[model samples]
Target: MRRVWTSYAFRRILQSVFVIWLVSTITFLLMHFMPGDPIEIMAGRLNSAGMSHDQALATAANIVNYDPDASVWAQYLDFLKGLVTLDMGNSLTSPSKTVFDHVMEYLPWTLFAVGAGIVLATVIGLSIGMAAAYRRGSAFDHAMTSIGSFLTGVPNYILIAAVVVIGYTVLGILPFLDMRGRVTAGVEPGFDPVFFGDALYHAILPIIAFAFTATGSFLLNMKAATTEVLTEDYVTVARARGLKPGRISRSYVGRNAMLPVIPQVALQMGTLVGGSIVIEQILDYPGVGQMLMSAISDRDYPVVQAAVIILATSVVIASLIVDLVLVKIDPRIKTEGQDA
Candidate 1:
């Protein structure tokens, strides 16, 4: 068990490194392709009388801690140096804040909203799917499948649009979705019910929106996986051995059936964490995804890079987690001698 865990941990580290590399390179290149200079964007509010194109270019170069005329290799080395030291550079729009600082400011919003939403959705969907599958041909099973299939067909953003519009435009009951603003309008006091209550109150809409969009996917995936598991030969043999209904359902059916869903669960968790930018935007929740959008809008290269790197790291780590989970749940997956 120890050896297997060690092997999995090593692989996770390797994948994490690869994702970090990919994210850094892609972020750097994408920043290069952006329409304007980080320097101009950073200094715009302060320097209303902006610099010339040349000056703006120079300012951008300075803020990014790079010599504009330096060789690509030199810039690459500097970039790597920054990466190693965790120096994510500066945000052009919010010149006072480093990229890391920017993300730090907003990450918790997403953790509470989309992160929790995904977990909630997964738990609910997976449990219900298992139930539906086990009760196949029953009215409840048919109802769940029919409803889930209908919901799963719609794009998440469309759902987001419909729901947000209804709430904001027609009902006017909830605060409109806007990702950039904090619940307390800026202050986050520690361990106070007033502060926590305001935060939760604001979080209510975004959480529901995210849950609605995510639950369908979870349900569909779980149901499909469960169906496939039920058809497996072991399930057949479990019944042949005269296993009790509940025991066979749990030990043989649900456990083995959940193997495929495990990998997807990890990946979806990563996506929920990283891909909630749209939800955050609509709802005004301050998360990493919202930070990415802000960085892009403001041409904050460092902030954008930092956010992407965080997301990419999550994906790689999730994949590794999925691998380990599969091995843990089913010892037969590992090569001989891997299991004690």
Candidate 2:
């Protein structure tokens, strides 16, 4: 067992290194080739105040605290070196905060929302799916399938937009989810209850949007898995053996049916925090997704590269967890001598 785990960890570590490198390279390239100059983003107010474009550009360079005259290759090397120090340099938008500091402030809140949404979606989706499969052609099955299909067809951003308008305009009750918080003018936040409450209040709409969009896919997948499992030979045998329906249902059907979804579930959950940028921004949730968006808009190379590396790390870790879970749930994984 120790040998198996050790081998698995070693393999995952190697994969992680490759993923980080790939992500870093991609992020660097994207930021490098992105449309619009960082100077424009940095000197927006100056431009509005009638600064010439050339003047604006130079000012932007000063604000970025880097010599834009440097070769792209040299800038990239510095960005990569910053990764080693966990120094994401400065954000053109925030101006004052390093990319690392900015992301760190917002990541936890997004993680909290994504974590809750995943747990809720999986539990609800699987339960509904199994019940529907058990009832195959019943009214409940049709109802759920119809709803799932309806939700799955719509783009997630639309749902987020709707949630924002409805929650704020129609309901007129929930507090706005401002990126960061709704602090008194100029007051710094220390994650106190006030800031936390403001964050939570705003999280509601984004969470709902994410959950709604994500639930449909999980339900559809689970339903298909359940249907297939129900028709399996083991399930047939269990029924023939006169095992109690619930036992046969859980052990014979649900267990095996859940196997195929294990990988997808892990991947989706891992991505939830980083992937819901549209929803996060629409609802103004202070999360990693929004941070990535800001980094992209500002052409903050160090920040973008660091965010990509973090996301890649998360994905690799999730994939590793999925593999281990697969081994545990299905001993027939045949990993014997090929432990890793």
Candidate 3:
């Protein structure tokens, strides 16, 4: 058992490294192969500021450490050097700012908005799903399944739009819900009550929009897993032993059923980092996903590459954690790994 665990741990570390490498390599190659030149995009901005096209192009190339005359191999080597030094280069559109700065500024917002949403969804979904499963084949169970399925089919952005229309435009009840930026414009920046309260207020709509979309899938997954767990022999034994219904539901069924949801929660958190792009855009919330979309549009290679790498690394690490957790939850996972 010890040997199997050690092997699994080592294998997971290597797999995580490979996943990051593969994702970074693919992003780099695909971006480089794309038709638009980041240099040109930069130069276009320069031209708008009155510089001649040829001169603007030359200046932009020098600023970004790119040489159109250089071989692709040489450019790739430079990129690797930048990566090693943690200098992800500069944004083409925003020449004065580095990709690292952009990420630091925006990544936290994504974490706040999407992270809160996923956590809420997991908690709510697990509770409701377990409850629904306890009354399997009842009207409540069927209704929940049907509603979850319907909501799961709708895209998150559409929900965001509908929420904006209904909450702000139609109802006007949430007057403090600012749809643009991370906080109210005049709020002092700090951990003070005013700032934090405003920040939370601003985040409410985006978080709700994201959570509403995320909950449905989690609900369905948890419902299925819980239903399966309730049918297991241990649950039957608990019932036969004259355990109280509530006690059996909580200790025997809920405890065992939650095992599957734990690893899934980790995986979902990873994907949430990338999946919140549309929600951010709609809400005008400043986040890494919003930054990434702008970078792609402006052909900001450094920002785009850095964002992709960060997201990929996040996913890989989360997946590794999930694997370790699964082994801890179910020892048979180690045996399965060994067999594979």
Candidate 4:
């Protein structure tokens, strides 16, 4: 048991768990410290819905599973207990649904949009970066580097704005108004092509925005990595062996060059997930980001807390997975950890 604590994977998993717990605790505290009282807010709505003041207060308290008379510490303990049980109680604003239900309903859309964008960006960036590196000092290489630098320097929101304006107002190429939600009206979700196609159609803009901003970093990094790898002795040995250019590029250059850029994928996942809030709002797509904004506006404490926890958990898990993958990609990481 003591030896397990020294293991890199075990330590990383423990650290990730700690980070998640810290995030959840902070979110719970922030919600509590916010100006409005969720119970009162719910009670007021109930009062306006034909219930007497006392009845509304009692009903709201019961529905929210929050006792106004309880000590703050007691309430916090209950919150933690609920978290442990995977029960975040019912939303103060939407008493009929649990916070988990709301999170589950909306999180997948954000995941789909952001996940697709990351994969597209990785492919485009890695391919272009490698090509540019091989042709270093040429006009095409210079052009690509300049474009990548510009893209990297600009904020994602700016890129998204540019995409919306150019595609909608200037070019009239994108049907901006028609592509406003996750699916067209009356399109029931199923395993069929229609539902999947329409969902992708609606998500295209957000995906493009994400990919556009992210591609620059990947391109720049991959280019640098590939350039550095080109000078290594092993690559020279491969060339001296009279290997086919394509084979040398794939086996010798591409595989090693990708090592440095692989970790960036996990980092980008977290960043894109956070950025999805504004992008989703601009695109008017129904996702967790929009749900989070709505919950914040309505002071729906449970929902807000749950959304934050979900996002934090995703980032932590991604980082953990990347850490493990790095050990597999470059065994030196695992060896170093064991030594430490």
For candidate 2, list the clashing residue pairs, or say none.
177-202
At residue 54, give the lDDT of candidate 3.
Answer: 94
Residues 17-42 of candidate 1 have per-residue lDDT tens digits of 88779778877777666776555565
lDDT per residue (tens digit) for residues 1-340 in model 3: 6665459888889888888778877887887898878788788889999999999998888767677788888877877777768786677877887778878888888878877898889888888888788788999999988887876888777877887888788999656345478877767889799987888888887788778756887888889988998889998998899999999888877777877777776666765676778878888888888899998777788788899888778778877888888788778888888789
Give the higher-lDDT candidate: 2 or 3: 3
Candidates ranked by TM-score, best first?
4, 3, 1, 2
Q: Estimate TM-scores for all models.
A: 0.82, 0.77, 0.88, 0.96
- Candidate lDDT scores, in order, read 0.72, 0.72, 0.81, 0.90
On lDDT, the leading prediction is 4
Cα-lDDT of candidate 2: 0.72
Write the residue-wise lDDT of candidate 4 on 247-279 in tens digits. Answer: 999988998999989889988999989988888
Angstrom error at residue 85, model 3? 3.1
Error of 3 at 193 (Å): 3.3
Better of 2 and 3 by TM-score: 3
Error of 3 at 89 (Å): 0.8
